[model samples]
Structures are given as C-alpha cells and as structure tokens.
Target: MPWNWTQAEWPNFHYDRAPLERLEQQFLVASGEILGAVRHVSGEDRERLRIDLLSEEAMRTSAIEGEMLDRSSVQSSLRRHFGLGVDIASARPREQGIAEMMVEVYSGFAEPVTDESLCRWHGMLLSHDRGLDMIGAYRRHDEAMQIVSGRIDRQTVHFEAPPSVRVPAEMRAFIDWFNRTTPDGLSPVPALTRAALGHLWFESIHPFEDGNGRIGRALAEKSLAQNIGQPSLIALAYTIERDRRRYYDLLETHQKTLDVTPWILWFGEAVLEAQQVTLARVAFLIAKAKFYDVHRAHLNPRQAKVVERLFRAGPDGFEGGLSAENYIAITGTSRATTTRDLQDLVERGALTRTGERRHTRYRLPI
Candidate 1:
C-alpha cells in the first residue's frame, strides 16, 4: 500500500481571509517583547527558572491529555522532567520503553539536523516507557498508514510504506528537501508556519504504524526549535487539540490543493493562543519573582537559592518534593540550616508545606 507517487488522493482547502489577516497582527503584538525580558536570563537564578518552566510547559502538552493537567500533576511532571532532564531530544511522547529517555534527549544536542537522524529520533520517540500509541510499532509488514477521522466517513486506506513508515524512503527525501531549502540554512519558514507544515507533511505521509499524529506534532516542535534556535514558548498542538474538528478540516481541505494559506492561518492562530497562555504563565512567574525580590533580604543564601529554584519550577515546575535530601544536594547546606531556610521562607508567606516526613514538598503559595 505504498503511495503511488502518481495517483495519491489529496484534499481540497479554503479559509476565511480577513479573519486570519487580523489575527496575524494580534499574534505579532502578543509575542512582541517576550524575548526582551527573557534574554536577561544569563546564568542567574532567573535563567534557571525560565529553563525549568519552559521544559515543563513543553512536556505537559506532549502528553495524551497534555493540553490540560491539574496543578499537582503539572508540578509532578515538572519535577520528573527537570529532575530527570527533559530536553529537545528527550523521550518524545511517542517513545515507550526506556527509563530516563527524556533525559538522554535533553543531555544531547547541537546544531540543526537532517540525514537519518530523524528516523533515529523517531525510533527513540517510540522507545521504552514513553508509552505512545504504538510502542516501537514501525512498519515491519507491508501495511499502510491510514486516516480514521469522521470526515472521511471512516474510510479504510491501504498503502505500502517501505523502509519505515516513520520516515519512508520518499518522506525522508522530502524532509531532506525541507532542511536543505530552508533560507540560508536558517529554516525556510517562520517557526510557527514550519511547525504547521511539519504536521501537515507527516500526517500526509501517514508514517508510522501508530503514533503518527503524536510523532508528527513532536516533529513540528523539534522543527520549530531548530527554526528559532530555542524552544518556542507556546504549544501549537495544544491549540490544535483544543478544536480538533477544525484542525482536521483544515488538513482535509488542504489535501486537495497545495495552497498552504489556510494552514498558515491555522498556525498563526494557534501561535497567538499559545502566546496568550505563555504570557499568563510568565506573569505568574513574575509575581513570584517580585515576592522574592521584596523578601530576598530576609533569607540566607541557601534559603534564597531554594526560593529561586521554587519559582523557576513552580507547581508546573520541578521542585522534586522539596525533600531534605534534595535540598541538601541542591544547596549543600547542613540539615539545621536547610530546615531553618525552609522555615524562614514558609514564615515569610512564600511557600506552603505539604505531606509529611520523607514525603514532604514545599511549593509557592498559589
């Protein structure tokens, strides 16, 4: 059931004109100046906090119900990802077996990539305990990647995917083309549009026995990171996940024609939504920082360090239960001093303590 490359059926597409043009302006204004303050994070505790929050945000939306998580889970995943080290190449949600695979991806990276690395990355995404739809379910048999959305009348599709569905020979060639054609080696399209196109192309390829959507989105994310030379502040997929119907329809319409205007509009709108949520997150973080700015004078060095860490890895961040053991590791302070530090912060109305004994965790007071 391989794509004939000659008679593959496609989709027809259209989008409202004025609405997108106006939304595009909103998107520009929304993201404006965000990087200004963010760039101030240079080896300071603030930098540490930004890294923690950014990674936490990225991982949350990568989950099955990633768009939404209760505060506790958000904090927990933050701790898990940061503590274990989730980064660009971390265990992508599609991977399913390895313990600390996310850590591996984060710990390793440099430069934009092409070649067979995508296939390797895609494989790792489906690797141990990441627990995606199809754990390591690459195409071993001659099965085709299919679409099962309601619009298609649940039509059954059958096509041959050779080499590997995740990066079939043809699809891989296209990826190579994309990487090469990027403007002056600086990503051909804006990060936002590139992300959308990455999603569109991969879905069209229908690569992978399972986890196509998840992997495709992840690909978009990585592709975006490459475009910007850093991770983007928003989860475009989260926006798509919010209104999955239009998400599919946009794709369906575009399948018939290659005009990417509607798809670009979809991406632009998603970016704007993502910016809104990210701005809210940053505002909360800034508030937390202001609390510390006012109170930093009363805290000992260790206490200050701990507070900074807490803000950086708020509830959706990576505080690791604020256990004494971790406190000792993070600050190298004595038991009595650490206790006093934690107590001082709590007394100052900066944090709330939960759980007991070895299970204790301290977090920012909402």
Candidate 2:
C-alpha cells in the first residue's frame, strides 16, 4: 500500500474542527489555572520546579526511543545551562546533549522555526553518537528510510519516507507550512491543532537520519509554547512514554490516511492529560515548601536527611513507602536509632506511619 505522502493530497491534511472546539477551550482554561498557581511559588521553589520538569522531559523523551539517562547527570547539566549552579565537572555526552536540547527548546520557543534552528537541535540531540552517516543535517544517503519491525527475513514495513532526493524540497515546504500556520501567521491554526499537524507532518518527512522522533516532539512543545505566549510547562513526552504502544499505533494509523480528525482528537486528549500532570507537579511543590516550613524546626539531622530523600521521589511519594530497613540504609543509623527517629517524625506530624513491626512504613504528611 502507498503511504499518505505518495498520494495526490499528500501534505494537504484535512480534519474536522468541530470536534476540537471544546478541547481547545479546555486547554486555555487549564493553562490559566497553572499560571495562577505558579504565582504563589517562591523564587527558589520556582527554580526547582523548572529544573525538575526539564529534567523529566529530557529523560522521558530519550526513554521513548529506548535510551535511558542518568537523572542526576541530566539535572546537573540543565542547572549548568541555566546558570543556576554547577555540581559535577562533566556529564556523559548523551546526558549533556539532551539536556542542552531541552533547555534550548524551553528558552527559544518564541522564535520562528528555521532550517538552521532545526539542524542545531539535531546536532545537540546526536552529539554523543559517532555512528551516523549524517549529523546536524538532513539525510543524504541514497536509500529508502523505512521504519520496520520483526526479524530481517520477515520484517514489516510500517512506513517508508520519501527518497533522499526529495527530502530537501519536502522539508522546505514542511517548514514553511509550520511557520505559516502559527497563531500570528497568514493562516493561523488553533494551538492544539497546529501542534498535532506539525508533529505528524515532520515525522512523515523523516528529514534526519536519526533523532527525528525527539526533534518532532520538541516541535510540538514549541508549538504549544508559541501559542500560549510563554513556556508551556506540559509533560508531553512523559505522558506519551506512559502509553508508548498507543502512541506508536496512532502514528502508524494516521500515516495511512489524510482525514486526521481522530489523530487530532487523540493528540488533544494527550496534551490535556499532560497539562493536568504538570499542574499536580506544581501543587506538589507548594505542599513541599509548606511541609518544610512547618517541620524544619523539629527534624533532627538524621530525620531531615531521610525526609529530603523522600521529597526527591516527587508527587508519587517514595516507592512502597519508606520502610525501617530503607531508613537505616539511607541514614546509616542503627536499628534502634532508626526506630527512634521514625517515631519522633511521626509524633511531630512530619511523617505518617502505617503497618506493624516488619511491615511498618512511613510517608510525608502531605
């Protein structure tokens, strides 16, 4: 079967706007709520929030492509980029590269999309690898770019992009369409609609040899940020990573047809879900600040150390809750000392304890 790009209507994508009307309004309302919540955060807490979100995004986006990164390294690289502070002397190339790309996307969202900008992002994303035929540039190899699965003998061709000969022209047109459909352009598409279409169009082109998936996602976030007139704090990549199977299925199905209404709807729902996750993260930060404010005076050195570790786990809380064994490991305290500290924390309302004896666990009050 021929791909959508080979058809007569090729890049002239058509989708019904009637279904997206309600979702667009919901997105705006959610954006306003997040902005309002952010105002109450202290400067220090706000910086922490930014670092956490960016680090999560950098990590998740790479994970979606089967690459796992070091959380500490990514965070440290991001902090250094933002001029917040520096801890480690150097990070692995993969960690440092993705961190640079995420920071660049967040800081330069308002700028128009250009070939140079896209190339720069591509370079940052693949700087660590030394095995690509082309890096920081479009694919020039005279072979078909096909996304495949299964064994080499019985493989399935999910989709095959246009030939290398057509990539330059195809990308030029794609870039023009993206800029022209911006909120302030000649043909202004709605925020979510533009982002969805832009992502699909870029993926269909498959301009680069590698890093297309990551760069395409960054484009979607950039589209959202541009429409909202600020950095969009949505966890788009993290949300997609949670349901990776569905994400790939949707993309594969949409690549076969031009009526992308269903794809747009799915994309909108994902964006909304991502927005909610971000709001919860912001709320968690607020609660964390208040928790520290109330319990700072009562916590001993060992108790304080354990509480800080739990907070690092974010809104999910510590996995399986903090057990007695876990506390001893973290604080290097004796069993008796761990028991006393845990009980003291519970009495002071800093931690909540549950279960009994061997099964006992503790968590933050908030």
Candidate 3:
C-alpha cells in the first residue's frame, strides 16, 4: 500500500543535510586514525591484519546470507590471491567462490561501476549455486519479487521490487547516478551518504534474482574506500550482523518513505561502530606484537609456533587456551616433551597455567 522511493511524483530524497556535516567530519577523523594506526605497524603485521580483516568480512557477509564458510578456507583463498604462503588445504569450490568474489570486491574497489560489472559480480557469487545457464544475467521472468516472512498462508510482504519490465531502465539510471556523482566528484553530498543512498536504491531495485544484498554491500565498500582514499580493514557487515534486528527494521521502515533520514542515521552509526571495533582490534594487535617482541628471544621453535598460532586464533587465544594434548598434537611432540615444553613456558612467564592434570590449559600470561 505504500509507495517506494521510485514511485513518488518527485521521487527524490529529503534529509537534514546540516546534521550530516558533523557525521562526515566524524567519519573523516576516524578514517585518519585508523589509517594512521595502520601505518605504525610493521609491514608483516599490516599484511596479516589486512588478510584477517578481509577474511572476517567475507566470512561475516556470507553468514549474513545464512551461509557459513570455513574461516581457514577463506584465509587460504585470500592467500592464494595475494601470493602469500597458504598452509591450509585446498578450499571447496563453493568456499573458494565466496572468497574469490569477496577478494575481487576488496581488490577492485577503485574500479568503475557498470551494469556488466555488477552482472559479473553476481555471476561469480552464484557460480557455485546456479546452473551454467543462469549465471551472469539479470532476471528474465516477469514474476513479482517480494521479500516476505511468516507462513505461506499468512505471509507479510516487507518489500516488493519494481516489475521486471522496468528493471533494465532502473538499473541504468542507478548506475548513471553512481558513476556521475562519485565520492570525489562535483556532488556536494558526502561520500558515506552517497554509499547509504546507493545501497538503499540498489536493494529497492533488486535487479538480480539473487545476491543483491552482497552486491549492494560490495558497492558500499567501494564507495567508502573511494571516500577514505584506500581500502579499509573495518568490516561494516560485522557491525550489521551484531545489530541485525535494527539493520533489518530500519531498511524495512525506511524503504516505504521518501525521507530516509532514519536509515541514513543508522548507517552512519553502523559505520562508526565498525571503525570503533577495528580500533580495539588494532590496539589488541599492537599489544600482541609487543608481547611477542618481549618474549621472542626466550622462545624455542616449538613454543614460538604455538604462541603464534594462539595469537592468530584471536585475542582470547584458542577458545579455552591450548590444551597440552592439543599442543602435542600440533607440535608433534611426545607427552613428556610437551609437558616439559609447557612448564618451561610457564616458568619463563610466557604462559599461565590453569587447572590441573588432563584439564590443564596454557594461555598467554597477559
């Protein structure tokens, strides 16, 4: 019963432009802080952070679509892309497909957007799902596309896309606007605002039969990268996943109104949350680096390898700390040797021991 953004007589957006100036200023300052923190890290640390953050984005974005990917496989796929050493097993085609598409999104953020480019992205995304005949093309059928919930008998339509007949024209207009008014272009609008509006517009069109959400997010990533002057390690989808209820509710509510201030406000907040989260991780990484630097000389090869793996496991370091049995399995050491190795680590103040006997766990002293 409600008119979408494309259906209004004026069909243009209205918002409090003055309030957005503050948001733009905040985003710029945060972006500089993130980039500056990145510059202070070692090149190897920076590379690892890039790979970890991009892999986290790929994994979380896929999870938002109800698809869970093995994080190691995603990391392996990215390593192969960057010519880094990959120690993991070969990834499945589906996992590789997801990772490959995300890698392309990360690496190609500076490239221009076109219908063909979007089609190719869609093709890559669905390559492992759809049949050969259905890849790399827009919807050809005239069926109504509605996002609905609840049972079939009582389904509630949250949104309905434009008819397939008008999809081409709609897509062309959207792409034209996107290319003409880029973040660095003559447009007075801030780049983050453009990213949010573009995301809403793309979702309303729903040009493809699948993967529209992923593509829209990819477009947002490109927009932010363009605005900030480099590809970012902060993953917006991570924050979206954390605030998914609000994310969905805002989109559902705002899509029906020409004034989309609420959605834009939520998007700005989401961007801030993502950067704040990344900033915390950046601090954790710096601490971890200092931790290693302090203990690097005291560690033997086995202890170093185990410490590195645990650190890479994340800030918590191995869910419950690495068990001695698990350590032996990983280090291929005998029980006696593993016991002495762990005790030596504890004695050297590199690790703290918890529990006793078989339940014993060793974690970083910090």
Candidate 4:
C-alpha cells in the first residue's frame, strides 16, 4: 500500500491519562524489585537490571526454546550501537540487545534529555559502525533500498531514501534541538512525548536515504533511553511491527496538518501498549522457566538440543536467527531427522512457528 500514513489529536489523548497511569501501576507490579523507584530508573539502575537478567551464567544459558544467543553477535551489536568504531567486528553483529532496549523505551519511566542527546541517540542507532555509508557518510549511506515489511495488502515500507532527500534544513534544526536540549538533569517532559516529537521530526526530515522509518523508531527509542537512562526497551518495535498499518495510518493523518499532538498521543499509547505486552512476556518466561525446573527431567537429549537450536536458528527461522540448515550444520543431523525434531517441538509446545517453507521460522513459544 505504498507506505501510507496519517495523524490525529485526541486532545487529552486517552493514552496520556488512562493508559499511562495504568502502565505506571503495572510497571510497579512487574518490576517486583523496586516498586517506588521503578518509575525513575537511571543508567546505572538500568545496568543493574541487565546484570540481574543477563548475568554471567544467564548470558551463557539464556535462549529462546533450548537455543541460546551467540555472545559474539551480542558483543558486536553492543559495540556498534554505542558507536564503537569497528576494528574487526563481524559484519552483522547481534543487534537483539539494542533492539530489545529500543522496545523498552516505551515505558514512561525514563530520565530527562535534550536535542544533542537525541542526535547522540541517532548517532548510536546509525552509528558509523552500525549505520549505512550514505551521501558523504562513512557508514552504509546508499538509501533507496526496499526493505518492505508487514502485510501483503497493507505493506509498510522500510524504504531506502535517496541521497537528495538526506537530512533537510528544518530536520537539521530538529536534530540540533534534540542535541542542545536533552541533558542529564532537566524538567523531564514524558519520554513518550519526546518519542512522539522525535518520530515525527525525524521522519519528516527523512534524514538518510534508507532505514529512515526504522531509524526514526530508533530515534523514538533513543529519546526514551535518554529519559530512563536504561538501554533495554522491552517491545516497542515489535508492537509497532505488529500494528504497523495503523501506525502508518496515524502518520499519514498527522502529516496532513504537520501537527505533533496526535502523533505524540499515539506514540505514548504505543509505549503503554508495549508495557502490557512485555509484562505478559515476562510472566510467560517465568512460567516457562518454572516448567523447565520441573520438567527438565522429561526432555530428552535430542529434544533438548532441538530447543536450544531454536534460539540460535533452527531449519525454520528468520531475521538474524538461525535456520534449519544452520541447525543441521550445528547438530550434524540428517534433514529427515532434523525436520522431525522441529515438528515435534512445535507440537510439544517447545518451539513456535515463525514462518513457513523457505521463509519459515520457529522460536520459543509466545
């Protein structure tokens, strides 16, 4: 559907009042570690959460299904996300951590920030190591790459922008605003509000030729990261990726007037919604962990291997995830046996199907 968009204003966007308050309350409930202070997580505080969730043992063991994440990718993506100049890092670093952090920014409980902070966020997202080398850019710069995602009828764009459309005048001002304004200490407007502003401003400018929407989202996420000082955004993009049609609709609606309120409200609503989803995911994860505790005895060696492989990429996988071929290579098993193992996992509730045939993906169940 040609990357259509829309915008609107709900005045006191039902999101800011109702959804936000509920989200705050729910966050207090989910955090469990700190009820009162969960509303104001700092950078250090955020690292603690990471340490707690992804400790030395946890980092090594944590995986979807029975599969675990490759530490190398994680480290590579982290370095790239931080603008760490790549010396000999792998070509496609693990970006899930950065992606996860971007999702978590949806929660309103973030720290204060400014324009420079925003640009810095963008820099991190489109860092020299991570971003493309575009018009005069050292990183990947060539835009106009068609990275279309979402539904067939209402497909959303992940379009590559033209160099001519690189960061324009007003947009440059906006980035400058973000860099100059956001600071370590400030009367914080809601992070989600700033996220909305950044999203609209970034997209309107169409800064780079490619990855603008994704980068705009990364921009929203960075604003939230600046606000909370925490790097993990729970699931905002997954949410946006899920409801991509409506998101584009709202953008198109708002673009008609160039107003920002409707978009802000929608963005806030998105953050709140992501919180609800992550809360459920956390609960499911804990439940599954408990299941493992009790039923680890019931799982067989191959069954366990199947599960472990799913996280890294089994035969049927997507994104940067592993594939069945990867699984076959890793496990050194025959295709017939591997396919059987994969199908069994899907039936046994160990692996969930993500795609089909050549494009199929499977991972830990939702």
Candidate 5:
C-alpha cells in the first residue's frame, strides 16, 4: 500500500477538527493553570524547574530513540546553555548536542521554519556523531529510508519515507505549511491540532538520515510554545516515552491514511496528560521548598545531607525508597549513626518509614 505521503491528497492533511475542539480548549486552560502555578514559584526554584523539565525532555527524547544519556551531563549542559554556573566538563558530545537543540527549540519557537533553521538544529543534534553520510543536510542517499525490524535476511519494513529525490520538495512544502499554519499566520490552526499535525507531518517525511524522531518532537514543542506565547514546559517526550509501543503503533496506523482524527485526538490527550504531569512536578517543587523550610532547623548535618539527596530525586522520591544502607552510603556515617539518624527523621515526621527490620525503607513525608 502507498504511504500517506504518496496519496493524492499528500500534504493536504484532513482531520475532523470537531472532536478536538474540547481538547484544544482544555489544553489552553491547562496551559494557563500551569503558568499560574509557575508564577508562584520563587526565582531559584523556577530556574531549577526549567532545568529539570528540559533535562527530562532531552533525556526522554533521546531514550525513545534508543540512546541513553547521562542525566547529570544533560543537566550540566542545559545549565551552561542558560548562562548558569555548572561544571560541564564531564558532558559528552551527544548530551551536549541534544541539550543545545532543546535550548534552541525552547528559545526560538517563534522563528519562521526555514531550511537553514532546520539544518542548524540538525547540525546541533548530530554534532558529535561521525557515522552518517549526511550530517547537517537532509538524506541524499538513493537507498530507501526504511524503518525496519528483525534480521536483515527476514526484516519487516514498518514504514518507508518518500524517496531522497522527493525530500527537498517535500520539505520545502512542509516548511511552508508549518509557517502558514501558525497561530498568527495567514491560516491559523488551533494550538493542539497544529502541534499534532506538525509532528505527524514531519515524522512522515522523515527527511533526515538520522534523528528524525527527536527533531520531530522538538518541532511539536515549538508549535505548542509558539501558540501559548511561552516556552511550553509540557513533558511531551517524557509522557510519550511512558507508553512507547502504543505511540509507535498509533503513528504507524495513522501514517496509512489522511483521516488522522484518531492520531490528532491521541496526540491532544497526550499533550494534556503531559501538562498535568508538569503541573504535578511544579507542585512537587513547591512542596519541596516548604518541606525544607519546615524541617531545616530540626535536621542535623548528617540528616540534612541525606534529606537533600532524597529531595534531589524529584517528586517520585528516591527509587525503591531510602534504605539504611543507602543512608550510610550517602552520609558515610557508621551503622549506629545511620540508625540514629533514620529514627530521628521518622520521629520528626521528615520521613515516613515502611516495612520492618531488613526490609525497612524511608521516604519523604510529602
């Protein structure tokens, strides 16, 4: 069967916007709520939230493409990009590249979608890689750009993009469509609708030799931020990463037809879910600040160090909860001291204890 891009309708995507009307309004309402919550955050905490969300995005987006980046390295790279002080000497090239691309998407969302801009983002995304026939430019190879699985002898072709000869023209039209459909453009599309369509449209093109998924997601975010008039802090990549199989299935299923109402609806709901996750994260940050304020005086030096470490793990709390051994490793205190500190933290309501004896684990009261 011919791919959606090869259909007669081709770039003229058709979706039932009626179903998405309520979702679009919900997205805008959630966006306003998030902004209001963010405004209540102090400056220091707000900057920290930005770095956390960006780092999470960079890490999650890359992970979706089967690349595992160091969280600290990505965070350090993002901090440096924001002109904040950070020890970024340990950051590798891959982490640095994605971090740079993410910052560009966030800061330059309002810029027109031009080939030069896209290529710049492509360059930054693949700056460290040495293996591709093309780096900053679109794929020019004659062989089919196919997403396949299984062994070479018995591979399954999931999807094949438009041929290389057609990429330049396809992308030119795509860039034009992207700009003209912006909220303030000659033809304004709704925020969620445009973002969902932009992502699906770019992924269908798969213009580049590599990094298409990552860049497509970035484009979606840029669309959202452009409509909302701010850097969209929605955890889109993080949310998608949670149910990756379904995400791919939906994309594959939708790529076969121009009637993409299902895809648009799914994408809209995903963005809404991502927004709620981000709001929870902001609320967590606020709770963290209040937790520190209330417990700071009662925590001893050792307890304070351990508590700080736990809070650094974010809203989920430390993974598997904090064990006594973990406490010793963090504080370098003796077993007796560890026991004393843990009990004191539990007594002061700074931490909640579960299980007993060897199975004991502690988590933040919040």
Candidate 6:
C-alpha cells in the first residue's frame, strides 16, 4: 500500500554510523589475518590459491543463479587468463565469458564504477548465451519488471524495480555517489561501508533486464577489492547460496525501509564468515605445496597425475585409497604396470599400501 524505499519522496537512506564503522573495522582485521596467513605460503601456492579462490567465486556466483557450470571449464578459462596454459580440457563459450568478466573486474579494481563499464560486464556475461534476447543493454521503457516466483496461478511478488524511465537517471546518481569523495558534496563514508551500500543500491536499482543478481554480486566484489587493496578470496556468493532464503528476505525487508543498517550488518557478517571458510581451505594449498615438493622429483608421469587426484579428493579421498584399477584408468596404464608402479611408490615411501593382492590400494603418505 506504500511506496518502496526508492519510490518514497526524499528517500535518501541513512544508517547508524557507529555500528557500520565497527563492522568495517572487524572486516579489515579479518582481511589482515588472511593476508598474513597467505604471506607465509610459497609464491606457487599463493598463485594457486588466488586462481582457485576466484574460480570458486565465479562458479558459486553462477550457481546462485541456478546455473551449474563445469568446474574444469571454469578453471581452464582462469588458467588461460593467468597465462598458465589451459589444462587438458577446453572451456565452453559461457565459461570463457564468465572467466573473462571476473578477470576484468579484478584487473579494473582501482577504476571508478561507471554505467558504461557495467554494461560491458553485462555483455560479457550474456555473450555465450545469445538467446537471452538482450546484450549489455538497459531495459526498454515498455517492459514491466517484477521479481516473481511460484506457479503462474499462484504467483508471488517479491519486489518491483523502479520504472524503466527512471533507470538512466537513477544509475547516474548512484555512480556519482560511488565515485565522489568526502568533500564532493557528500559526507565522508568508510570505503567498506560504501562497498556494502553500493551493493544494496545497485540491487535495488535492478537496472538490467537480466543478469542483475550476478552483476550486483560482482559490483560488491569490486567494492571489496578496491577497499581492501586486494582481490577478495571471500566467496560471499557461496555464503548467500548456502542461505539464499535469508538473503532474499534481507533484501526484501531493507528495500522497503529507509534505514539499511540491518542489511549492512548482514553483509559484513557474511563476509567475515566467507573469509574464515577461505582461511580453512587455504590448508589445501599449503598441503599441496608440501606434497609436490617432496615427491615431484621421484614421481613418474602416471604417479604424479594420480597423486594430484588423490590430494584433490580431500577428506573424501577414495575409501582405502585408489585401487590399481582406478590408477590404470586414470593413467592409461596396463594392470601389470599399474601394480608395479604402486609397489614402487610404496617402496619409495611416496604412498602407503593397504590390503593384499587385487584388494590392494595406494594413497598419498602426506
């Protein structure tokens, strides 16, 4: 019965500065700890962590939109982006496009956010799937927009964006606020706060006909990158996906009120949680580095490839390790050769052997 936050007269939003300031401080401290943990890793591990983190971010962000991407394809695109040569498999066009968008976003972290830049990002996102009927363009004035779900006969309206006529001017103002400084006719706001507010503002605008969710998340990533002075390892989208219902509810409630403190708080908490998860995952990178250091020189090609898969398997690493059949399948080796190789690895202390005869299996010692 009433206007949404954006549609209200003089809807200028504000929040409790004290709480946001505290959250920003906490975020910075958590980021600092992650940086310290990262610095202790070897250069190779650091690079791998960077690639792996971004790959996860890209894949998880797309997953939030209900799109399941092939992890290898996404990783291939990322590998090529870093000049790290593609793996055995090639990336699909859609995967390549998403990878390109992420690389560009991280590369341009220091630049100001602009409408044109946002459009370009949208184009890259939709390039592979041209059937989306729109390409990096704003919505048409005649198209009615609403976030709806459920059966057509039982439709539920979650939110409605501002009319198409207001999009251009709304975006212009948002961008100006984003780029402006403390003395530029605006109050001084912490960079992290700006990042959180920017995310909320962009999503509320819902400027594009499609890809708004992904683009909005990317914009938030941009803010975190610019403010933190590093591309983020925090996969906020992953956290959102894990709690999608609450994420949507937060947006719905905040967009209807002028006070956005709750939304900002929720975002900050989510970021902290994501970074903590990343820190735990960093253990894999560290272990990987150590594993390769001790075994690379001793391992044959087949053994090396098999070791990679075992390590990648994490805690779920095959029950009783990998059998000769699994090893042969992975390395294209003969059953006899696989047996001999596994025996040699055990003798070399590179792997541990369990069971006897055909029931035997091999696993990384480390």
Number of the top candidate by TM-score?
Answer: 2
Alpha-carbon lDDT, every model: 0.56, 0.92, 0.81, 0.50, 0.93, 0.80
TM-score, candidate 1, is 0.58
Q: State in Å the error of residue 118, model 6.
A: 0.3
In angstroms, give how far residue 222 of model 5 lies from its true place.
0.4
Cα lDDT tens digits, model 3, 33-55, are 99999888888888888888888
Candidate 3 versus the native: TM-score? Answer: 0.88
Which model is ahead, 3 or 6, in terms of TM-score?
3
The per-residue C-alpha lDDT of model 6 at residue 339 equals: 77
Residue-level lDDT of model 5, residues 3-36, one tens digit each, is 8988998888888878999999999999999999
**Candidate 2 or 5, higher TM-score?**
2
Q: What is the TM-score of each candidate against the true structure?
A: 0.58, 0.98, 0.88, 0.51, 0.97, 0.83
Tell me the lDDT of candidate 2.
0.92
On lDDT, who's better, 3 or 5?
A: 5
Q: Write the per-residue lDDT of candidate 4 for residues 311-340, one digit (tens) a residue.
A: 333122345554677658767888898788
Q: Write model 1 residue lDDT over 143-241, tens digit each, in one string.
A: 444454355666543333334534556565556655753435633655555556667766666655654665565566566555545455554555666
Off by over 4 Å in 4: 1-172, 179-187, 306-366
Model 1 RMSD vs true structure: 9.0
Angstrom error at residue 80, model 3: 1.7
**lDDT minimum window of 10 residues, candidate 2:** 84-93
Question: Clashes in model 5: which pairs?
Answer: none
**Tens digits of per-residue lDDT for model 2 on 123-233?**
999987899978899999988999999999999999999998999999999989888887889899989999999999999999999999999999999999988989997
- Candidate whose lDDT is highest: 5
Looking at model 6, the pairs that clash are none
Candidate 5: deviation at residue 260, Å? 0.7
Model 2, residue 62: distance off in Å is: 0.4
Pairing residues by index, what is the TM-score of model 6? 0.83
